[model samples]
Target: MKFRLLLSLFIFSIQHLISQTIDKEKLLEYYESQRYADAAQYLQSMYPSDTKDTKSLTQMAYCYMMSGKLPEAEKSYLKVNSIEPENVPVLFSLATINSRRGNKAKARAYLSEIIRLDSLNFNAWKQLAGYGENADERLKYLKKANTLNNTDPDVAYDLSMTYRELKQYPQAYEVLKTAIAADPGNFTLQQAQLPVANQLGKYREVVENGEKLLKENTDANVINEMGQAYFYLKDYQRCAALFKTLEDLGVRNEGTLYFMALSYRELKEYDKAEIYAKKTIDEGISNHTSIYYTALGGIYEQKEQFSNALEAYKRGLTFSSSPTLYYRLGLLYDFNLKQAKNAVNYYNLYLKNKPDPEEKDQIEYAKARIAALTTTKELVKK
Candidate 1:
């Protein structure tokens, strides 16, 4: 019985040695040719599923992955991971396979294990960020990833985006700045920084970086950013010019028209301001038409054009009865136009909208003015 057991053990040892001794040149040739399926098959024929050879199993799994036989690859990788439980590459491969197969929970599990084993794993954190269920969760993962390896451009970009979405503009700007410094030639990073700079009131920085980006690509977003920067910088001429280019390309939206109107108004060019103001109203969304009119009225009011402001507010009432517009109309009539009865009518309209709590001061002023306007006392009584 002892002799028979020894013979069986020797045979098993020999079989394992022979399998390991097989010429690997053919496998190399297959890999060199990018014939991944052939490589996988070659390894599988030499190494059985129950083989204890981790190297062979890992090689087979990689080939299966490259050959697009994901199930086979996953199985092979699982075997390798069982043999070498701390193998990060094996875990990463499993994570990738599960992610591609839409098994997010499994993918996240693998990634979490990787993070638990190697807390500074930058790619693991980045992957977790990608799998995050919401913006805040994404931000949490991305911030960790960025801290792990801030020089990684893709992670930097994603982290910057999450920061921007959370309205954490300063952090977004800092991340993007570091990333752009690391990868000066990445135009996407360059373009992304424009809005962050704008949000932080870094108007000159927006103009500087934005101008450089535009020279490379005429992105409408970059152009708009430059326009906004120029407007805030009080460089109204350049602001109008940039938005005009977007308008000429027929890519103009209400924001474009609004910016153009404001630019011209700031430049004391009332006719052009009115033109863009009308364009803004034309692009007004349904049932929200009064918003554009209010903006237009504001532009005229800022320019001390009281009659035009009156015209704008009254014309706005044709589309929708906006409480803010009603209040503005009442004020104009009470102060500028000297029509107390007209003022009281608009005050009544303003009161009926039940303005938000934020507008309590405006509401109180309207009520006091209504009571004090003696010429409208008869109208108020009726």
Candidate 2:
């Protein structure tokens, strides 16, 4: 019996040793070729139980991370950390996982630990300066990162964001300029730069560039930005004119219709506003429900077309689940048609939804109107 046990143990030891003796080079080649699933399977099949096989274990961890097997990656990477406590790359990889999993604070702490270990880690410094931090601190970290890798597009974008947070729009523009100069075909940089220009009230810059781009190759997004810039500058006529041109050019999308409604509403052209608002609905624009309904209802109510106002409010309610629709319905029924019973029903519906706290007093006033109507009905019966 003792001899049989000894033989079994010897065979197990030999098998383990054979697996440990597998080549690291072949595994890495598979990884580099982007065959991550194959690499992971190969690494796992030959995993070494030996304490000194740190490289094999770390490779297994990286393979798991690459293949999106995060739980397995976490376990393997933890093993790598145990073997190589000073491995900055491994720690940064763990930090990235934490960030992707939405644990930003943990990710930041891990990044800070990396910075502590290697003070010149540019990527770590740049990531640590992202949004919701003090602008000065972000700038300091980003500037440090840029010093290490000035030509990095990501670093340039980070520095631009830092400057934007500081409200230093000109500096942000310059940083974007540097980034674009490095990679002129970077559509992302152009998209990011547009918002910074808008934030800085650089309307003329937006209009000029956007208009030139429109002439060369017009796009819906660029045209929307240009329209917003004109709207910001209070150039209602020009804004309408531009959107009209877009409409004529067959860019009569929901967004353009919404903008047209806004422009016409701003100009106090309620009839035009109603036309475009209806167009927005017909085009299935989801976001314009509030203003579209309110504007349309207001236009009809102003014209004393009570039935039309009621229909507009009801249509708006179908698309949106807002209590404001009920409130508007109640007001139109009470004031326009003098349908006190129907008005009371809508007012009660609005009250049930708890519309807004500021409107609480107004709702109480509406309740008084309902009570007065009830008393009038009783008197009429007498």
Candidate 3:
């Protein structure tokens, strides 16, 4: 009886070992096929307390990482690192996990170690660039990545942006030009090239790329950029057309309205210009309220609506002490309304603001008006 019982116990142990081996084989197959959730389930069931199984542990870590179980993945990765210190794959995995977790400092340390282990790791350098404390540090890492693989469009794009952040538009433009030449079909590279070109005052490039982007997508940003380029190039008709399209698309704002007003004004469409100018003031560009009000007054004046122009300029003075507005008020009162006293008051206000050197003609005109108005006032009193 004792011998039979012992034989039964041995048979049971052999069956248990066979089951575990089969389960492990299934787990590995699942992992190899990228079925991480299945692999994780099998690992949890068969090797619940078996950190000694380094292969299983590594597979489980990757499974956890792929499944978005970040904390669990991090714990598993730490355990794997303890067993095989300085494993490059484990280090890279840890870095990626920490980066997703927003632990940038820890991720940077891991990536630094990876680069130290293998200096030619382009991915490590590229990842490190995003963790830099400043633009200079970012440039250093991005430059290394670009040097390692200049043909990589993504690396070139990142390096170009870093150059743009430092206000090095010429360098940024050159980098993007090279990148676009290499990857001509990449629409993102083409779109990015526009802003840098615009900054360099390459309006021709802006117009060309912007038109191409518009064909693919009528994105409001692209439309605004194209419209601005047209405005700068003195193509008011096209500029107004684009801005009107933006308005139809429900993108009316102070900036778009202001540009629209300017475009229509330049094209002698005073009524349309006045509508947009009024909208710009109502929408309120907080820093440039005076400019918008002045524009409204100018629009009204262009329509020969002197009373409205005077009222607009007077209301604008409540918001800003703009010398140009004061000068315009002086002219309106002197020439349009024939009020010498009011003209003298406004002309003196204009002189007080110390107008720019380019305003020498206006300055001389204001002084003469002040003298003439003062003399006329004295003669009327006598």
Per-residue lDDT of candidate 1, residues 251-298 (tens digit): 899998999999999999999999999989978756777888998998
**Candidate 2 on 1-382: residue-level lDDT in tens?**
6754553453344345443554545654564577887877875777545434656566667778888887787777778888887789888888887787788887888788889999999878878876326778878888888888776888788788778877898888888877788887766676567768888788888888776666656676677778878988888878887888888878778877888898999999999999999998888746677668878998998998888988889888877656788878888877777777777788778878777888877778767866776778632443
Which candidate number maximizes lDDT?
Answer: 1
What is the TM-score (0 to 1) of candidate 2?
Answer: 0.56
Query: Which of candidates 1 and 2 reaches a greater lDDT?
Result: 1
After best superposition, candidate 1 residue 155: deviation in angstroms?
1.5
Extract clashing residue pairs from model 3. Answer: none
Q: Please give the clash total of every predicted structure, in order.
A: 0, 0, 0
Model 3 scores a C-alpha lDDT of 0.84
Which run of 10 residues does model 1 get worst, by summed lDDT? Answer: 10-19
- How high is the lDDT of residue 366 in model 1? 90
Give the lDDT of residue 233 in candidate 3.
97
Off by over 4 Å in 3: 1-20, 28-35, 44-53, 286-382
